[model samples]
Target: MSVTNSFDQLATLRAVLLATPLFAVGLTLAAYLLGICVFQRLGRPTWLPAILVAALMLAAVLSLTGIPYQEYQQGAAWLTVLLGPATVALGMPLYQQLPRIRELWRPLLFSLPLAAGLAVIYALGIAWLLGASPTILASLAAKSVTAPIAIGITQQLGGSVALLMGALLITGVAAIAFVSLLARWMGIRDERIIGFALGLNGHALGTVRAFEIGPTAGAFASLGMSLTGVLTALLLPLAWRLLTLAGMSVGS
Candidate 1:
């Protein structure tokens, strides 16, 4: 009788787990629609992105309901996996912008290191100051790249992939919401500067916002996103390992 009861419970649990994806998607779409309504009501400022609000609302709902992040992630993994193909698709537009890229190599080359350095430095410094785990710090160091690349680097560096994902999402949203305002404040209104700042700090969402701004901004944003990914992937692990070797203990 106990064995039969256990089997029934297991079957029920399996059924619930199988239904999780549908639940997640339904909730996500509802949240996005609600966010759009809210944004429209709020006058649709560039500093108040709909996607950010939607994601935050969903996150709050899931947290309040005690949903295991694993369950939500299982449902969301489809979009995560599609990111690779989507990134590749960006290359089509990038190809059209090749001449512009070539013309700006001097500034682009200089900006790559400067932008990447600031990202890592700011993140690592803050994490360390907070006495965060080495793994958390390492994950922070990868937060600016696309999801797949960020996840890969985080895993290799012994960081939490979920933490890295959360950081990336937060950074992307916040950057989109604030970078334009920041650019205006600093008088950094050049299209390339605007795009590069957005991409280096915000990644894909920033690129999306840049496209909304204008073609020139989008081109630079795309380039910044691509280069940030390549540089962060190639350099961050070595930098972490070097830190460990240098008695800094970045991610042990």
Candidate 2:
């Protein structure tokens, strides 16, 4: 009788949590806040940054509670909706630095294609070398862009959007969390270089991480992200075609 009653109570609680939107929203905000606090208390180190901590905590909570991703997303969607506006707001600071940025436009034009092309080449090459399936490779080809854009590209390429999104999210987080350390270790100074690399490789998560370093880094990162996004969108299809052609040539 006691065991049966405990199971009944647990089921009741689960249903209640799933029904309440606040449950998911509150949990997400709280997790991020706690992550910030923990990161600060640890002396603001990069290895365990606040964003990463918050993400892990949220993941752990969801896993432990057995909450479906859809259920959590219901509440988190409100916050996710703000991402675009927030990123756009970052452009103001970049705008203030436009004179400096303008001076680099010539370099920017030359570098943009190289950066975008290399990103796609490396992603596809590594995946191919690892012997990933064509579907998986197709999905991963656009992994550097934001998820929505990536999904669109994946669809055009006959890949699963779901698989693209999964890989996309993982790479975004991993890049944001570790790229700075990697940059420093590799002796790549210059905020512009760091910021640009972060934006190109990390996307939104990298932009956020760049802000933490300094305003200048943030501005450069925003530029890198915007440039890469436009370039990637415009060139990805052509790049994919060439890559496939090369693959066919090599195989033959």
Candidate 3:
């Protein structure tokens, strides 16, 4: 090839490499849109989550093609990077719900700490029973919160990021699919309870469903989810360490 043509070809290849992440993002977006359309056509309930379907499809394709997760993540990480700003964007909804929050300040204040404590207890119990490493257990604990916060907490607590991502996805999907059933079984349909379940248990997907339910529910759910993250980050590890020390003391 001529020197000019060679340089042009390399430049084109570089552009393609740079565009690869967009392709991953596009695949996820297309899957989401397709899922919505398919679910709507089937007349499925709003609770039928589309993200799980998209994630499964993408995972299958990646597995079948033998594309290294490292390469895929290189492009996929861009989408991950945007997750921070997207989470912060929820402030818009929370802002509108501020007056209601003030009216229910006592309940809101009470629920945050309670939810966080419950989360830590549940995670540690499960981890101990499953024989998970400290890091894996920590990652699992982080799973109930938003991705950016979960990831940061996971790293700080010595958890596997990949495992944490998987756990988070599973937790969110389960909460979306089953929380309503759990609520109805308990004879509860209060928006606050529903919203708290979503935020505390469901993360983003549950919060999305909460928004559909009503503003009050959505507001509380967002608060629950956000504060749970804060609580998990601050206290889960310390509690874990204390519990471990207590056990060691007893054993000795």
Candidate 4:
């Protein structure tokens, strides 16, 4: 083969190699690992949560590569599939705090629904008030839930998957970053309340944040995140139905 032909073959092979599903998955994992490495090296500051850093890095990769989302999703779906098992694992934490859960069951009954409703209300309602498109409103409805459930809700409601992912990422990151500051500002010193706030507003991210605070808070956060997710899942659709009936739904 000619020297130029061998060079051309190498370029073609490299392009084909990077296009695989495994490469996509590897890219995601590498981005996250890189973020963690950076965080560790930088002393783990609040401003640079590993996931957010990873997401930013992944976005850079996607933008630079010009690869379509569909191709990336093919590999990323592997991660997506694990959300179900992770959700089930959340019950273990809840079980450990069963006594606290019982003791506070009364307030929880009142508070959880409010938490779930408000997350959606603050997100979608504000968007609606600001004249956001119907698609935007629908996408925001599940912004507080964990990603898997949120994505399911978004898809079912005819919202954009990309929008749902973006909203969830932003919401989670904000929750982790601001929850502590907001707690101090609001005079919420109680760990249960702190956990509830994190779980209700942040979902999985909030739960992770809660764990960082304390185990009791982590348990409450798990409970709060699960309850909020359930409530949002049920209520968002019902409310969306009512809005549609009232002729408020915008075409997707």
Q: Write out the backbone clash pairs for model 4.
A: none
Q: Any runs in candidate 1 off by more than 4 Å, and if so which? A: 1-20, 248-252
lDDT of 2: 0.78
C-alpha TM-scores of all predictions: 0.86, 0.80, 0.83, 0.89
**Cα lDDT of model 2 by residue, 102-202, tens digit:** 87788777887887788788888899899999899889888887654565678888898657766766777777757777886998777776777777777
Over 4 Å off, model 4: 1-15, 18-20, 248-252
| Model 3 residue pairs with clashes | none
The per-prediction CA RMSD against the true structure, in angstroms, equals 4.2, 3.4, 4.9, 3.0
Report the candidate with higher TM-score, 1 versus 3: 1
Task: Compute the lDDT for candidate 1.
Answer: 0.84
Candidate 3 shows a clash count of 0
User: Tens digit of lDDT per residue, candidate 4, span 61-86?
Assistant: 88886767777887678788888789
Q: Compose the digit string of candidate 3's lDDT tens values, residues 1-252.
A: 699998788767755754668766676688778777766776756455677666777788778755666667777787888988978887777788888777877877787787667756686687879898766777787778889888988787778888888887888878876888888888987887788788888888788878878987888778878878777778876876787799799999
Local accuracy by lDDT, each model: 0.84, 0.78, 0.78, 0.84
Give lDDT: candidate 4, residue 118.
72
Q: C-alpha displacement of 246 in model 3, angstroms?
A: 6.2
Worst 10 residues of 1 by lDDT: 243-252
Q: Write the per-residue lDDT of candidate 1 for residues 84-114, one digit (tens) a residue.
A: 8887777776788788878889988987988
Tell me the RMSD of model 4 versus the true structure: 3.0
Candidate 4 weakest lDDT stretch, 10 residues = 243-252
Output the better candidate (1/4) by TM-score: 4
Q: Per-residue error at 178 for model 2, in Å?
A: 6.5
